[model samples]
Target: MPAESQRLYERIAQKLANDISRGQYKIGQRLPSERELAQTFSVSRPTVREAIIALELDRLVEVRVGSGVYVTNTEPPGGKAGATDIGPFELLEARRSIEGEACALAATRIDDAQLAELNALLTEMRTENEKDVMLSEDADRRFHETIAAATQNSGMIAAVKMLWDARTRSPQSRSLSAKVRATGVKPRIDEHTAILKALRQRDPEGARAAMREHLTRVIDALLKATEVQELERARQQIAEQRKRYAASQ
Candidate 1:
């Protein structure tokens, strides 16, 4: 296929996948007909079908015969908020910038009621993490979200939530997370504690530093995982080529 046509299909697929991740199309929800999609995207029916095929490869949606296409439980394929193709690294960089400011603002504004609730969430996270690491991480998300909420800025809250959403929706982000999970690396409770401590002291600089440090650690971990992923890919390619050579002989 020509590169231009392939890119168009990929662009369409990424747009649709972004909508699905944002809950415009719920799981099990049927997508518009190909004819409708083509019209909406200003493309041909064949182009829409190709986009659907790409999404299907990611397991983000299922196409049924004589019925319709529907969303699946799998996360979407790309990050489309800032740039055409935002990778996980870029998304995290954006978060570290925005969320550090959010934490700083939250320190000045958080109330006692909110502080107590945050503490409760941290406790729950620690308990659940002890039981099952992945399942417990929902609290980790909520913890950051709550900090954004304390800032009392709806835009900041939305921005933070969108970043978290992309972490799952983007294939590169998911792959990095999966690699880290395979290594049994769980969330660091001490890090969350540091952020909370800063918040409790009503120290904006401390809170900012803590949040920045936490995300920096996350970026480091992801970098390490990506290196491992690349190494494993090289190993697999070598193995496949050796098999082909032996078979030819």
Candidate 2:
């Protein structure tokens, strides 16, 4: 596909996904008419239809008989938001820019009530089970977004919201998350805890530094995983070629 098309779909899909998850369009709520979406997106009607169809494929929305599109039963896919395609490096870089600022602003303005909410989320997520760890990191994203709101910076709020959406929805995000949690990455957990502490203390700079460190650790881990995935892809390709050659012989 053309680069422009790729970019357009990526943006539109993310917006649609956000609307669904944020309940801008409630479950079973009919989406705006395709004509309306096309005007809203400032693109062709076919482009709007394609976008909607793509969303339906992901189970984010449904098309009902004689009614407009409706959000379906399924949760929107995480991390990439609705991005149809995004590579690991792009994702990590985006995370750095957004979370780095979110933590900074959060420190400046987070209230006791917000801290309590985060504490509750931390309890729900952080655990060392005998055999498994349940990493509810979207809870982590929600906390960050809430903090962005506390900063009362609209730009910060919007940017962090998008990054958080992508972070929570990407397939690679999910896979690496499960991998990291399963392997027991403890210091990273500590980093988040420390960031939370900084927020509780209302130290903006401290919160920023802690968030930066946390993201740095996550990026390093993701790069290693990306390398492994590259190797695996190469191996799979070679194996398939070998099978074909043997059959031809």
TM-scores for all candidates: the values are 0.59, 0.51
- Deviation in angstroms for 207 in model 2? 1.2
lDDT of 1 by residue, 62-155 (tens): 7654457889844844432222334556677788999999999999999998899889988988898778767766888889999999999999
lDDT of 2: 0.66
How many clashing residue pairs are found in candidate 2?
9
- The local distance difference test score of model 1 is 0.77
The model with the greatest TM-score is 1
Residue range with the least summed lDDT across 10 consecutive positions in model 1: 224-233
True-structure RMSD for candidate 1: 12.4
